[model samples]
Target: MDPWLSMYDFTYHLAQEIAEKIHERNRYLRNGENPVKINLSVRTLLKRLEESIGQLRDSLLRSVSTRQITQLEGDRRQTLIDELLTKERQLQMSFKGDGTEPDVIRSSLMSGGGAGPSPYNPWVLEEPEETRGLGIGDLKQQQQRMIREQDAGLDALSNIIARQKQMGYDIGNELDEHNEIIDDLTNLVENTDTKVRNQTRHVKLVDKKSGSCAMMVVIVLLLIAIVVVAVWPSN
Candidate 1:
């Protein structure tokens, strides 16, 4: 059953009782002049009551989440993961690419057999003039440039990729949790609504009885008037 609806039920009945009392008090007001103040303290009381309930609501919601998660087993979790992946893919696709190409220059420099040290395996620059016939000075300058480029490239890539990965994981978990929560809340709300409808039907039944009683009273008065008229006819 929905804890929220149960809580609301408690609160609603209290409000109804207070409203009935207020109505009864106003019914006896003399001359219908200078309306009685409804004791604004009622508002303060409700506010405090809401604050107290809010704490309970929070605790209950957490408990619901935990129960839902626990019920969610391997298949469910996997399904949730798949759903999350689909959403993540859609998000990735929605972002229009800025058309920036990969760092090809850095790629060539980092690859083996380049004039510079391998980025993945940085080593002292061997004199290339003796092998590939490229001047050592030119090779050294190129190596220095490649090294700087690789350093900058690595720094830029590290944070962006890491942050994106982290965000994907976080969003997936939250979505799964949120879905479970909605399911639980929906069930609870449906049950509460059923109860409210039942209560309303009961109220209507009472009103119908009251209306019938009022009609009977009216009919009796009319009969009395008819009897009085019939008896006065001789005068």
Candidate 2:
């Protein structure tokens, strides 16, 4: 299985677990549970989901360097990561009495909505029909949870963008390396061409000197022959 796809599949499983836990918690919260109790917060489940997402991101980054995955595949992996994030945010908004639509989590996870009263059913969740009265302390804790949710999501997004930038740098570095090799080859060719031209020029100069020496010897021999013939005829 593709690393990214496998990680994304696991995220859905985690999301299913969180949905069941939320249902169970809300079932209790409505029946005399303390309004101020945040000890049962699904915050832990959310962290697990985030870790799954982080692993997916890490997997994709590794594939880029080690497997040399294409840009298109990388982009699809990124889309899956973003989808998981969207699911997480929707899940966070899924408290009972929050007035959120039933499909908030279901539609994000699966196109087929959900099933039976079993909390184990994927995306099957239960929430209070109306907001429960909360003490000031509970309200504060809820506020803090929301803030933390936003920060965690942002941090995840920041890490993803940073990894993408790093990938870009890796591509650029490879291009620089190729360009350097090309440049070295070009210089080698030019240097070889210059040496060949110099050798040709030296050969031509040697030929010119040899021709001059031969012409001088022939001229001297002709002059000596003319003097001998003239002197014998005079004698």
lDDT top scorer = 2
Show model 1 residue runs off by greater than 4 Å.
1-134, 137-141, 144-148, 177-181, 206-235
For candidate 2, give the lDDT of residue 231: 85
List pairs with backbone clashes in candidate 1: none
- The 10 consecutive residues of candidate 1 with the worst lDDT sum are 93-102
Candidate 1 residue-wise lDDT at 31:
20
- State residue 163's C-alpha deviation in candidate 1, in Å: 0.8
Candidate with top TM-score is 2
